[model samples]
Target: MSGVAGDDPRDPAGETKLTFPESWQVESSDGLSASVMFISGLIMVTRNRYLAWPSLLLSINSVINQHPLRTKEGGNSPISTVILGVSALLASYLPLVMIGPQKQVPLPVPEAQ
Candidate 1:
């Protein structure tokens, strides 16, 4: 093959460089954020203080770890995750604020021998 025709091993003139479409480019996965969001949703639904606090922390982590350029287009936003987390936290703890903590009844003490 002629070098001018790019059939030669060292010839790059006639070779068309392959380029994937912009849409074909792989975007970064949002698995951790998605999981955090899901957990936030569960926390909201259950209003469990134990789960709510950790879910908020995970949501913050997702925000901190997010990369704008590599993130998928039209994907879920980290801000939304944070909002959900805050909402979950509120849902878990708001009752205590509005209604106050329940007073514990003291058990009867036995007389000392």
Candidate 2:
């Protein structure tokens, strides 16, 4: 009857019997990671569109990780390498986004005496 999180999952007293119906639990780590990526992506997109790219990629990876790969065609290839490379590539361009578009200024001219 004790519902404590850390309590032992078993009961030693035979006087009382408790039965739990079949149930399932999905671990939080994966879902949490994906949710975090998605939320961060949403925030970034709203605040700064360019910086959102990395978060988008990360979220995509999280999604992809959840599903089984289609056709084990590529054997011995490091799938993560591609994901990491793309993320890194996009992240590398983050500074460019921060700098934003460039503008040209007219040169100043001195008046002739």
TM-score of 1: 0.63
Q: What is the RMSD of candidate 1? A: 8.7
| Model 2 alpha-carbon drift over 4 Å, by segment | 1-26, 31-46, 67-113
For all candidates in order, the CA lDDT equals 0.83, 0.50
Model 1 steric clash pairs: none
Give me candidate 2's TM-score against the actual structure: 0.27
Please give, for residues 36-91, the per-residue lDDT of candidate 1 as tens digits: 88888887787789998888898999899877766678888899999989998998
Report how far off residue 10 is in candidate 2 (Å). Answer: 41
Instruction: Report per-prediction Cα RMSD to one decimal.
Output: 8.7, 13.1
Per-residue lDDT tens digits for candidate 2, residues 1-113, read 86775466355543356787644434333543445455454443445444455555655565566433422343222344335434544555676789988899988998899
lDDT of 2: 0.50
